[model samples]
Target: MNLVPLAAEHVSGHALLPFSVYAADGRLLLPAHAPLADVRVQAKLGRQQALFVQRADHDAWRRGLARAVDKVMQSNASLSQLAQARPDPVPPVQAPLPGEEWEHVVLALDRAVQAARRDVGWVRAVQDVQAQMRAMVCRRVDEALFYFIHTGSRRTALYSSRQALRCMLIAGEAARELGWSEERIAVLDKAALTMNVASWQLQDELVCHVGPIVDEQQRAKIDRHPAEGAWWLRHSGVTDPAWLEAVQLHHDDSLAARAPSSLTPGQEMAHLLRRVDRYSAMLSRRAGREALSATQAAQQACLGTDGKPDPTGSLMLKAVGLYPPGCFVRLASRETGIVLARGERANAPVVAALLNAEGASMAEPRLRFTTQAKHAVCTAVSPGLVHVDPPLDRMQALHVYLKSNGPAA
Candidate 1:
């Protein structure tokens, strides 16, 4: 039977009894009668460090549950032994920001990634489909950047897809800027995803580094994951030698090397991937460090005289744009909203402000051409300023606000 674990609170109208069975050797695999009030059998089970549904559908999960029960009976555990208090209620979801479609798309893709990670078939399909999708996004980004190089447009286009997609887009943009063709782009895309596969190999403490203080040496070791990650990728049957080579040399600083030298097209693309990966890491809401602003990032980029970002900041700006769309901003009236669209005008596309800092509905969003408004100003409030994480619920609130307030006039 295929069954995935459904959250306990979600369990309803089903009459379940605590029962157990024994094995041929008369050994207890799981307790027989789990006390309904003592030890709780949560709907979740850790399958390879990732949670899997042990009772949702009617396939493997159900079979696993039955097997577990059989083990319990053989062990001679009583029903009361499995009883425990229900887990605490999950925290409320945050509302989405007004006009933040891209964030919503990215969040949805995160759910897809989680699902794919749980199912092997889905994982394979994700990799295959995302490879092609990555190429498309990369080509698009290159075109956009080429336009920027000519027109000096302040705005840029951004797409939110799986990690593979993100990597592809970043690598492709760099490749195109450097004039690499379709074949080279494929090599870069392969390297980008494989370089980070074993990211799951690191423990949470190491991944998060949630200790008292991490010394410089430890930090350096953690930073070497790309090199280690590449080794793992190569071992995993990644056939693209050029891709693996790029991955290994991505973080190395031997500008003067042997095999094609360090600054070759493939190596340069890999270097760009390294920067994008670092930028993605910082974008995540990690504890301890304050998030940086785009303007701050731009300044940081200036600090590096390498014609690229001083140390890897420019690609982020190139990827996300100087003023990223969906970015939340406060108006002159102190109203809050996210960017809704991009425009060719010197300033302004469209914005949909939903609230005031005090948590009041905006009087109404007044659409002013960012360039034509009395004072088109943007405050540099970093994402860290908000304690609550942005989510769909937040956007629903803005949707309600918009439905009530009508268009930004």
Candidate 2:
């Protein structure tokens, strides 16, 4: 979609807007006919920084010039139009570069999350960043999982923020599957985003700290982060009790045999958060420790120490699939590939073959539907074992959207 820059007059105090407003980077700022009442929203457009409207709005005000030109031609008066006017050229609005949001959003989100930790006034800022990330996740869930999952391991600099965002996305995916209300999901997303707020900096530090943790203080902080994080959120003006409770109880590994459907909303949401948080942590490499493969991580998340299956974990698999996107796998035919999307069944996923049966890189990744016997997944494989560095952006853009602006059906 094309965009045009807006001046202050374009959006005045509390007026119902005629057109939707967007950030300079294409994020929606204010919807059509909505009042611009939030101080934080106005601040984004201040300092002469650019805010935008759809190009059609600009064209609407420009069409009058065209009408006057037509009127002069209809009059048949020679030299009546006077000297030719030299108009000052107005520059065209630029579009965001391809994959710019996906590439930049991770860093942008990290900054927002870190800023929020320092100041309690950054509520809207953090939520705004989360909304943009959630849009990307909802738009292309598999691509999002692939983008963050791959980035999450390669760089531990922003592990705390990246892991939290990944967990929020996973919760949203599962929540959508369970047919939860949008309002309920919003609360879940917020809780997931801030579950580790109390030890965010510590999380990033731990990721790069090699060997056994000799820091007893840091070890104790990790053990009590859940309750402490909830308290921090309360001081930050988080009013939703359920949201706080979810964050507080996020580490309740003691949940035994409790079904998701029977649990209270807060407990259910917390259980979902716990399942995703632990699942993502296993995939992200910690210091000298190698990350667990997707299969190993899933087994840990889904099964208890006694080998009993957790019902909510079962719900996660049903929602996100057995071998979710971003994990590498070996097909029955000996070809190695990356899972691109979850298929109808847990075992069958949409895969792109990176290496041939002979373990050589293919000229291009070949998309395979693992439902077919010839293409069924044989086992999970490590990223180091796959010889090719997957072209994530190109492969992501190749996905066919079944809807106008969302994941495929």
Candidate 3:
């Protein structure tokens, strides 16, 4: 018997199975001769779950399956070619004015976190943030990260939302560079933002804990967060299959190990999200561990725990740069600054010097071009190393400076 998705609206009512339908895992979902309702279809899709109906007619089902398989194969072939071709280095886009739109995102995320107990309102808040992010154009990922980190550090005691936003921005950038369509990129952005929402409390605790997790119960909850978050989104009325699937598999590393030939589109996006998530975690400062330097994070990401090369690692490193935006660094000249924009080379980035060689805070931020060896980045520093009278104001001023300098080529 040929199995087909229950969501194909064009299928005739007569074509549906007269017998009970089971999910892929053999769980009975729809009773015999049940009429397919739009709500039911949506709920199933929201979980990134699928229900299959056995074809009443074998011949037609075979034909449909053959066509579906062929299409997927063709798409995979094209993706393979695209992956092999080295993408040209695109100049970094200019940072957009972080006025109302940036504030809106922060507010929306805050509301979402607060409304998590109320599922519908929380989902609406998430959608609001997604809409704002989709509407935002030509904004540098680093700029977004800077605003998110600075704002979140001051506004909330929890770091989950901040980490979520960082992952979202990083994943969105990677998706764009990979030539994903805007719609797909938006879905990715939303998925990344909500990937850890279900277990925020637990995650916050774990992030603050020193060393590795020794509690099996806590470890299990952390491991199950992705699936739990996907379930919550489904119950909250999320109907996009791609968004659901990306969230469900965001923590799965096995997808990265799979050969491209055997991978599905959802798995491909999941690979990207997983890589970005790992990289973002490394750059973030947890309670006991200082944030890894951009260069160190890049190296760790490129070489996985098992010593295997990650397929998306190089792309992430290139996109983020050796001194990713929002990161603190000390220059060869003994000055300290925040990375402003990616330079022509991955190791070279434009930095806004906040401290002079003597460790005194500069009166105003000075833009330094790291392409010149004399002003090269000496080491990635932690934020605690330097003092800024008004941290957020200095960051904003640096953003304005980068904006005025034009896009990096």
Which portions of model 3 show Cα errors greater than 4 Å? 1-104, 149-156, 304-309, 387-390, 407-409
By TM-score, the best candidate is 2
Stretches off by above 4 angstroms in model 1 are 1-126, 132-183, 201-224, 254-262, 305-319, 331-333, 340-350, 356-369, 375-377, 387-409
Tell me the deviation in Å of residue 270 in model 1: 1.8
Report per-prediction Cα RMSD to one decimal.
16.7, 10.7, 22.0
Q: How many pairs of residues collide in model 2?
A: 0
Residue 287 accuracy (lDDT) in model 3: 71
The candidate scoring highest on lDDT is 2
Q: Please, what is the TM-score per model?
A: 0.50, 0.74, 0.68
Model 2's lDDT to the true fold?
0.74
Looking at model 1, residue 11 earns an lDDT score of 26
- The collision pairs in model 3 are none
Tell me the lDDT of candidate 3.
Answer: 0.68
Model 3 over residues 1-409: C-alpha lDDT tens digits? 2456664333333333334455664345554544445567435434645657655533344455556556656677676553343222222223345444576566568668667767676887887777766555344456676655434323334567777777888777777677889888878878878888878878777777888889999888888988988888888888888888888998887887689778676677778888888877777767767667666677777676676545577677666676777777889999988777777777888888888999888887888888777788889876545456335555665665455455443
Q: Which ten residues in a row have the lowest lDDT in candidate 3?
A: 85-94
lDDT of each: 0.45, 0.74, 0.68
Between prediction 2 and prediction 3, the one with superior lDDT is: 2
User: What would the per-residue lDDT of candidate 1 be over residues 1-409, giving only the tens digit for each residue?
Assistant: 1213233333221233122212222222223233334334332111122222222222433454556566666777778643322222222223234334333433444344344334434334435654545433331332222222211111112212333345555556556555678787777766665554434333223434454555765566557766775665555455566777677766665632334343666577666776665554433333355445435534553236654554335445544555444344565656555544333431353455556658576545534345545425465345555333234344334433433343352
